[model samples]
Target chain A: MLASSSTRPRRVAGFLAKSAPAVISVGLLLVTWELYANHSGIKPTILPAPSRVLEQAILNRGALIDNAIPTIRATLLGFACSLSAAFVFSVLVDFFQPLRRALFPVFIVSQTLPLVAIAPLVVLWFGFGLAPKILLVALVTFFPMLVALVQGYEATEAEIGQMLRAMGAGRWRVFVLARLPSALPYFFAGLRISITYAVVGAIFAEYAGAAKGLGIYMLNAKNNFRPDLVLAAVAVSAVLTLVLFGLTVLLQRIAMPWERVGREPSGKGRRG
Target chain B: MSRLELRHVRKAFGGLDVLADISLSVGAGEFVSILGPSGAGKSTLFQLLTGAEHGAGEMFFDGAPLDDHGRHFAFMPQRDALMPWRRIIDNTTLGLEVQGVGRKAARARVAPLFAEFGLVGFERHFPAQLSGGMRQRAALLRTVVQERDMLLLDEPFGALDALTRAALQRWLEQMWRHHRWTALLITHDVREALYLSDRIYVLSARPARIVREIKVPLPRPRDPTAAAAPLASALEAEILDILLNPQPFKGHDDD
Candidate 1:
């Protein structure tokens, strides 16, 4: 018990040591921005001081949070839809060779179309509501996940597949027992890449047209010459991305404890 | 009764014949080793047995013709082939799971054998966390857990270090002695063939046919050391001669 308790602080120390560089760099960037804004004496409409931005953020927290709800809702709903759709699409592509040959090229072509170019069209079709924002988020997040899942499925060790088949595992069983589990790490990697885009995609959708959201709020703030409020919304977006990324990392930790344990030094000498 | 029989079996990849008129058998509860040089269709033989490759001729198990090659025998490939994502116990139970056994029941059944297989305390560990030997043991356990009539082992210890290989060989012999599962091992190691097999079949180069078959008269748990067993040395030398200088065909005329 004593040993276990002692190791907890040591683990915390290790974590801090590992994270110190990133924290320090971000702190320095914030300090530089604050110093520059304070000394330049620019008009607040054009370039607000960091303190002014913080003060505006505190004063308008209620309005900002109300707008944030719809944005968060759209992101989560869209992400969930993309996750399931990507899984199904990846499985189909993996199972059917002709479909892969036909649809994979189309998927690549779709990705080449810029989200900015497509967002307005989606909003025009789906209207200025949650539907358009969710559609845009799903479009932006689907492809990376599908590609990663396909790569993961293909990367399953051939020998293991053969072994499973010899043991009487059918095609679906082989996929579930071997392919699906192997694809998880890649799936999570794709999730991490695509999740950061989800909020931004929702915001772009909202910028095109929306009843209320952080994107519309920012547009109103910009038109009213409240640069501080616009910047505050941007900060909230960054925090949202960080929180989602942290959640993905946490999910990975819970789902794959083996990967973490494998990397630790076991201290046991090699056994013959 | 013979557990397995390959009667005049033949296989060809397109026009390139890999196994020409290969015939062999393993009696019930016996250990047989097939020794061959690389590219001698040793793996092809396993592919045929596992229904991965189609071949012409009869394959019988326990006096009945095998309608399907896959269901009758469990197979271990050259590599450990344990799923990296699964815990050791889960990986070992994969065969049973695929055979329609419930996961909990399969785990319950396999849990007791971990100690016997030298995999104690690793039931919850991943494949990457174990050493090479442990992975192979877990793989072997996976193969055996299916409770099939026979096992097809394709150089299961080929990738291990020399010490680990020897140790696993002893462990395998002990397991086989206890369970008496009919097993066919494919290897090019002459000493390994002599030490573990009740009989050995040596195959020639490409378009492999059984060039020689030697029955081991040595007793159980045969000593592998050169000083302890003269008969093993003699058998090893005989098998080595056959492998080095394969005799030309005597009766068959087709080249």
Candidate 2:
């Protein structure tokens, strides 16, 4: 209890230390925008003041939330599907040499097609429904995860693999016990990058064509000359990205507690 | 009967000979050391014995020709090679787990030995959490938990500092006394070989062949600090002489 109590203040201090710069910068950005629009007499349609954006967000809370539900759902479903498919593809490629040779180049080529160019095509092919949005998110997020996982699998410590093989472990058993666990850090790294892309991808897909989503809401606001509402939708998308990134970090911590334990001061001698 | 016997083992990598007509045997419950120079293929010999490399050899265990080398010997390479992600208990039981034993049963089997191996409270700790000595002990525990008939240890303490190495050498002697698993250690430290083994084989440089075999006549619980022990000094000097002067030593070759 004493240790826990003592650590609480330290935890707060650590959080402040990490977040202070970002908070200050964002605060400065808002203050500058508010002064420029309010004092300089810029029309709200061209540059909405911070207060105007906040007020408009408050007024449109119900619509914003209603649009957010579909966007969040699409992002999550796309991310989940991408993760599973990437894992299966990576494992298959790792297992079979011919498949890796055949599929790796294709994966690289697929990533080169600009998302802006493909978003419209995906909407046209899948229709302006949830399918296009989810597919767009999956396409944008899949490559990073696949590349990270394959690298992780290939990076299994040679000596450890040899040791397991000498112990009569089969190939699959070696992959499961040694390679899979070794790949986790890389996997999480990929997840952090791809998770941010997931939300943005869904928004882009919605912008191309969608029945309901934050992207559609923002598009309507823009057409109606409501800059404050568009800015409010942007804020929602930023919040969603932050939430997803934070969730990935939390999941990583929970999944690999041993990694954290090893780094703590256990009051022992130097590890090496 | 000897627990393991290697008769005229010959291994070649490409066109280069690594081990040529090497032969040795370890009696049941005996500890033997193979001492050689850095490039003398000591590790290659182990690779051959463990079936990581195919070589022309006749390997026998308990008077029977050994078919599956992996089933009969537990091996520890020079590095600790502990999986960083696995906790100590899981790493210790890795061999048993690979052999199809359930994780819980494997953990139970190794739990009692943790204290004896100086890893009592570190069962749940990861490899990076422990000190170098602790990691090595955990690795040795991993090997011992396999319950194999013999152990092939290649320079297990070579990477440790002088103090830690000496301490672990003593601990290893104690563990060997208690467990009595036939062990074959490959090392370049003459003192380590003399201090631990009942018999020592001195190998030549490249294309390693046994140059000499000396018996350690010292009694059990031998004192490593007994620099004056006549037999230990004599064996050490003889091995050093053979290592330093390789040309004349070929006269002693039985092959």
Candidate 3:
């Protein structure tokens, strides 16, 4: 009876502990900003304090909301394009070795070219609306996804593959049963990196030139010398990134509940 | 009639030969054990039989070559090899599921064996959740669930603790009698070989060939006899001889 009673509360406590890192991080940054504003004696227009920023955020919630919608839409659209493209390319690389061999070097070389250098080119080719940002996000995200998939797929044991073959399992069955299941964790790991890349990449492209998005807002605030506004836009971007990445985590939770149960014992972290 | 015949079988890895002109026959419904020391190529022979690799020479199942009528037998490895993600029942149903049985139908077939093997309440439990002995039992169930006439076990209990190993061996003896299967077991344990087999084939180290064939006539449920009396001493002595002096009967290059 005692054991059963404590379980729910323990679970709640455990959840709070897992979330501690993100909370502490955002909290410490907020505190630092408040202190810096207090000590600097800067004018509110140039660099507003956290309290002033919050008041402006509240007062301009209408404006912030109007801009946030377009930015969120672009990020999601770009992320979707990036994911679908990476998945197809990864499958292609896995299926055809010669293609992978030829393209892998090209991909490495592509990464060496700065996004700043390439974003304008992508924007010029695809135009300003949504296509260029989506294309940029896909370019940034695809490499890590492809590399991760190949590594995960390659790590499947030859012995297990042979065992499946001996069972009279077909090639597809061997892949689905052994290789696919083993690669799931690695796939999720790649997805986390891809999601962050998607948002950050989209924003970077927007900074190069976009009519809308938080990147443009940051650029406007920086030009006007409103550090608080820049910081506010940054805060919104961080939260947006967190939401996208958190959604990936939640998807993984639903997809692979067995992972959490098998991996860590209760109360193992140093959160307290 | 012989259920299996390894006819003049030869296997080589590049310059090194693993099985040299080996030949053996197993009678239908016979409980045969292949007993040999470690690195005796016993596992390699089993792998050949199971088609883990293609090799020279004919491996006939019931008069037909294995190439002609495959998928009629099941092979259980030394390790459980259960997928960590799958539940015990799911693991048990793997072979049938692989054979195109629906999940519901396959799981239904395995529902009966759970009670018999003390796995009744643990159907939903994953392989990681089960003990070593339980995992082996689960792996064995996967093989048997296929309605296979012949079962090839490769040291299925080699990883278990002594007490659990002995208990499971007795359980296996019962299971074999209750449900007759032409079984070929590979084990290095002489007592286990003597306890479980109708006949035991002792093989020489690398490029393994049969050095001795010991026939155990100790009768049904031999675990009792194996545990007590002169029977234990005799089996121990026979196994000890191979361990103490293995030079004269050495076969081919050491594995």
Q: Candidate 3: misplaced stretches above 4 Å?
A: A1-6, A17-29, A42-48, A95-98, A157-160, A263-272, B224-229, B248-255
Off by over 4 Å in 2: B227-230, B248-255
Which pairs clash in the backbone of model 1? none
Model 3, A211-253: lDDT tens digits are 8877777788789877777777776777888898999899989
Name the DockQ score for candidate 2: 0.65
How would you class the docking of model 2?
medium
Instruction: List the candidates' TM-scores in order.
Output: 0.93, 0.93, 0.89
User: After TM-score superposition, what is the CA distance of residue B169 in candidate 3 from its true location, in Å?
Assistant: 1.9
Cα lDDT for residue A239, model 3? Answer: 82
Identify the superior model by lDDT, candidate 1 or candidate 3: 1
Question: Local error of candidate 1 at A238, Å?
Answer: 0.6
Could you tell which candidate, 2 or 3, scores higher by DockQ? 2
- Tally clashing residue pairs in candidate 2: 0
Q: Candidate 1 — which residues are off by over 4 angstroms? A: A1-4, A269-272, B226-228, B245-255
| A1-272: candidate 2 lDDT, tens digit per residue | 88879989998999999999999999999999889999997899999998999998999999999999999999999999999999999999888979988998988988998988999999999998889998999999998999999999988887788788889988899999999998999999999999999999999999999999999899999999998999999999999999999999999999999877777787895555
| Candidate 1 lDDT by residue in tens digits, B103-158 | 99999999988998889999988887888899999999989888888999999999
For model 3 chain B, where is the 10-residue window of minimal lDDT?
B246-255
